[model samples]
Target: MTDLHRLSIREITEGLSQAKFSSRELTEHYLKRIATLDGRVQSFVTVTPEQALAQADAADAALKSGTAGILTGVPIAHKDIFCTSGIKTTAGSKMLENFISPYDATVVAKGKVAGLVTLGKVNMDEFAMGSTSESSYFGATKNPWALDHVPGGSSGGSAAAVAADLAPFATGTDTGGSIRQPASFCGLTGLKPTYGRVSRFGMIAYASSLDQGGPMARSAEDCAYLMNVMAGHDAKDSTSIEKEADDYVANLNATAVKGLRIGIPKQYFNVAGLDAEVKARVEESLKKLQEMGATLVEIDLNMTESYVPTYYLIAPAEASSNLSRYDGVRYGYRCENPVDLTDLYKRSRSEGFGAEVQRRILIGTYALSAGYYDAYYVKAQKVRRLIQQDFLKAFESVDVIAAPSAPTTAYKIGASLDPVEMYLGDIYTIAVNLAGLPAINAPVGFDQDNLPVGLQLIGNYWSESQLLSVVHQYQQATDWHTQRAAIAEEKA
Candidate 1:
């Protein structure tokens, strides 16, 4: 039999429907793998064996009764940021370390209804602030490719789990490259849907305007399956779009890149510190796409120069406003022996939040302050619009824009102590989030270290189906996504 843990969602579902194996057997296989390997990866914050086994049993029954969905009996992990009923949802912060959600986040609930079993809640950057997952209060999630290297931020845990085959796929949130950067770092396919394409209800707030939840998996086809279950309008979330969800998988193999106009953002190639080899790999990918019947066009997107600063300012400002609910009076962590209301607020926040989260909060508060609001926050909003306009103009003649997901591959843990250096790692991905467009990270090649290098495809708003199809076509022609880390081979 094939390695149950390594099979894709489509394969797993087909096997279950055919009675090749029970959902209990598949779920237990993943559970045992997680118990054995997650210690080394540090991917999961909580492992719910009891909950998972119960759900797997139900899935087995459903499969036997001929009532199964594509994801029935499949196991996946959720980023700790998403609220899960009766499960600890930490957001990788001490502030919510003890908090148990009474209701599942819309995404989690939806996945449960789809017959997908939750393996566990994975780790993330504390409050989703840092580009590296090291900022988590629970401790950093190590890159599965290289244990000494850092997994990309916020959604690192989910990325690590999928890359290591601890679970078939996982859910991740992309506020500022949280999904794509980690996917790039971990050698996985990840998608950040258009803002409001997926409900943000019960997702711990980071930057309300930029925060979005999406899927991380081994291949574009798997991600498309997960997206079908995850995307839709929900009245519970005010930010949720009212449009009907489309069948993301139906167009997977039906579309081709022939005559597809692929735009190359000139600014992306010439970024100050982009690795030469990484640039070469991106160019090679473009050439591959062109050979596959796509045309490449070099386009100028000058507003990209201002994306990093604009995003830092705007995201923090929104984060400042959204995270204000975690005060002492609320359900999160509270300081003991507070002398007064002021003391409680000050001590609770000071003690609960990590350095990175505190740093962003202070920066956000300052940006939104009376004296700096116009100079920083308001001006940043204007620049954000300019960036969006730049993309709009570029898309007029092109079907999609392509760029390197990150300037380089995964770096050693603690190698980037300077905040600016760490933040700059996401230079290519932040702009898409600022513009609230859909983007995907697909492995294009490997660096000198043999670490994965990914190229990003950015699409206009609500174009997730097109983006996934493009990625699927590219994967069909390349073997980059099929390469797994030595850890998987070592375990086998």
Candidate 2:
């Protein structure tokens, strides 16, 4: 059982099946790691050792009785946005800090049926509205690659936990690159399935149209395994796709890179802000894919410049609507004293929400206001349709689109005080969400700072199987996915 923390999800399952170690043993190892390392990493908002052990014991018994699922006995962390019954699902905001969910999210429930154990709730941007983990009401999650640098936000804790070996693989929600960006910064594989491909029931909303849940793991193979359990439609989710779920694991092994056409967006490579080293790594990854028999076709994303503006307007407008339920009269945080109902609602939100969340709410409210709605909100939706059309047209000529996951490697947590700069970092990622297409971020190579760089693979809608297969093939040819952060290996 030595170095058990370093094993992949597949390896963990194999060892558990062979009785090499008990589920309790595996669970304890991770809990111990969290207790030992999380002080600096600060990834988990709440660690459920007792509940996790209980699940692990159940899994061990199932294994003995030949009733275990493929990932039975495996431990996974959930981003705090996903509701876990009786657990405090913070969504990294103080407004819901004490709000205990009465039910599990569809994703969590599915994982339970698959025999996966829950380790804890991980920190995230407040209401999943920020691009950096620093906005969490619980506090920021530090990157294991470099403690001062952020892991990436919203789903940053999930990425950091996996990257730091605090958990095997964790569930993360992607809204405009929350999962993929952090996965890129942390050197992990993070997938964002097409909109409706995964159930969002019980997962707190940021932007109803843009948010999607997926897995963040050590490699695409691990993601594929998790996706099998996570991708099915749920009757509870109105947004869930009604189609049958694909066998992601089978597709990962069956699909080959040869003859696959990967689109190279000229706009992505020509960006003035793209870091040279990060660009180099992206190019190197594409070259490797080409060597594996994939064709690299130069293409244009005509709506590239419109992505950021359209996303900011649409996402915030939806966020305003989704977050309005958190009034002082509701279940969340309320003001200590209020002279009137207006005072109650105003003070409660002002005190509960973080600065960034408040900023977005204001922007969203104004965009949705009667006088400006048509000019701002309506236009953004139109631009959003164009963005989706851009992807659809590109796919007509290429099977996948290749681009840099982030403009640069993970920077210091507080290095950028400018919100515009932060928004620009997501330039290459926001379009996929607008298009409702599946995409993944795979560690390609390291930049000069020794921080990891990610190569983003954008797939057509409902093409999770093919998207994952391509990353898996690339992973099989390289060691980037297998590389571990040094901080995780340090002795207590």
Candidate 3:
């Protein structure tokens, strides 16, 4: 049971069943690590030691009675974006800083049902709005690989915690690459299920259409185990498709990418700002897959340039609508001594939301404003369809599209890039969300800076199982997935 922090969920569950360690012991191990290391990483918004231990005790009782399920007694940290009953559900914003959810989100509820012990709530970009997690009102999450660098966001806290071994695996949400980009920066595997593959009932709305909850973990197989618990239709979420999810871990080990048609978008490498080392790592990964008998086919996605603009327009428009409820009148933050209703609304939102969130709200409000809806929002929707059609057409010739997860690896924290520059970092990933497709971000290799570079695999709708299978095969062939940050390797 040495190096308990380094074990995957599979290993932890097996050890628990074999009586190698009690769930409380493992829970305390992670809580201890969080106490020691999280000050340096700043990954969690709230660390629930009391409730976590209580849950661990319950899991131990279940194990003794042979009532434990696959995820029983496993410790997991959740991105603060997911609503947890009684636990603070801050989407890394001051707006919800004091708000506590009265019920568990579908994802959180499922983990609780499976006997998973809650470690705490990790940090994120406010309203899932930024790339560096710097926008969090709680504070920025530093990368465990290098403290000066960002962990990527708005799931940066989730990525940082897992990278630092504060938790085995954590949940992350992908709203235009929040999960995948952070996993890419932190050197882990993250999956964004097909649009409706996972329920959004309790996930706070950033963009109802594009925001999706997913798993961020060390390897694809680990993600598969989580997917088994996380993915499924929920009657509570109208957007959640009425589809039965496949047993993600069932065919994981035996799955192969032989004869898999991997699409290479012609525009993937043509980005002016894409780093050369990042490009080299992705290309090398593709070559390795080629040697594994997978065929590479060049495909055109001419709509690549429109992804950023269209997504910005659409996500903000929806965000403006979703966030309107956060005024001073209802739950969340409120300004004191407001003179009137107008002042209350204006001051509360202005003071509560971070600068990035404010910027998006303004942009969204303007896009949906009278007389401008069709010119901007409507046309963006049209472009979104074009983007979706591009992928649908590519799927006709290829099984999955492969590209660099981000244009660059983790940048130094507080680099202070402009909003547009930050938005461009997601250029390779936003298109998948616009098309409502499943994608995986897996660590392929390290860049010149020694930061991890990810190779993103884009698959057709409901192709999560196939994507995980391909990544699992890749992990088997390479040791990159096994690499841990130096902080994780440091002895307790």
Each model's lDDT: 0.91, 0.92, 0.93
Q: What is the C-alpha RMSD of each candidate to the true structure, in Å?
A: 1.0, 0.8, 0.8
Q: Rank the candidates by lDDT, best first.
A: 3, 2, 1
Instruction: Write one digit per residue (lDDT tens) for candidate 2, span 249-288.
Output: 8888676799999999999999989999999999999999
> Can you give the lDDT of residue 233 in candidate 3?
91
Model 1 whole-model lDDT (C-alpha atoms): 0.91
Judged by whole-model lDDT over C-alpha atoms, candidate 3 comes out at 0.93
Candidate 2's C-alpha lDDT?
0.92
* lDDT accuracy of residue 429 in candidate 3: 88
Which regions of candidate 3 are displaced past 4 Å?
Answer: none
Q: Give model 3's TM-score versus the native structure.
A: 0.99
lDDT of 1 by residue, 310-422 (tens): 99899888888988888889689999999999999999999998988888889999999999999999999999999999999999989999999999888899884698888
- For residues 427-489, what per-residue lDDT tens digits would candidate 3 score against the true structure? 998988899999999999998778999999999999899999999999989999899898888
- Give one clash count per candidate, in the order shown: 0, 0, 0
Model 1, runs deviating above 4 Å:
none
TM-score of 1: 0.99
TM-scores of the candidates are: 0.99, 0.99, 0.99
